[model samples]
Target: MGKLTIVAHIKAKADKIDLVKSELLKLINTTRAESGCINYNLHQDNSNPAHFLFYENWESRSLWQTHMNNKHLEDYMKATEGAVDEFVLNEMAEIDS
Candidate 1:
């Protein structure tokens, strides 16, 4: 209904951080171009080479769902099926802000 914010914490396979970054960044760029996207960004952990995070904002839950079903996103997921070792996706809403 309201805005949806998605936070994704991922850990690439050993020594595959760069590969994951490249692919994930491409998907994030494409997601930013989507009609309902509010913002999209990727961040790396300072101490952990294999850890990365994706922060994304969308107009609504429905729009976020659409982004999840995007062709490019699907392709990215397929490509990283084996390359990715761990993933944690969290969704949220701003309670007061």
Candidate 2:
């Protein structure tokens, strides 16, 4: 199977940007340590402080699925409830060169 690439766009509620940022930051270390993780990076938009993005690469779709069901991720979802205004997650595969 091919590697899985994920692009996640997250928007924080105006009043809750700090809270959302903190929660998202907490995922970095843990996610990087997960099995089959190739890379997990987080970014903030220069033009919009409330806008955030994550770029993640995993060995396979099954590993990515494990990441989605991780306990820490579940806690993050609960903690960010209502603090996040929008979230879009996209999964992709690299095209052979």
Off by over 4 Å in 1: none
Residues 1-94 of candidate 1 have per-residue lDDT tens digits of 7899999999999777788888888886678899889999999998997898989889999989988888998888877877888999999998
Listed per model in order, the count of residue pairs whose N, CA or C atoms clash below 3 Å is 0, 0
Q: Quote model 1's TM-score.
A: 0.93
lDDT of 2 at 2: 84
Q: List the residue pairs that clash in candidate 1.
A: none
For each candidate in turn, give its C-alpha RMSD to the true structure in angstroms: 1.0, 0.9
What's the lDDT for residue 17 in model 1? 79
Error of 1 at 54 (Å): 0.7
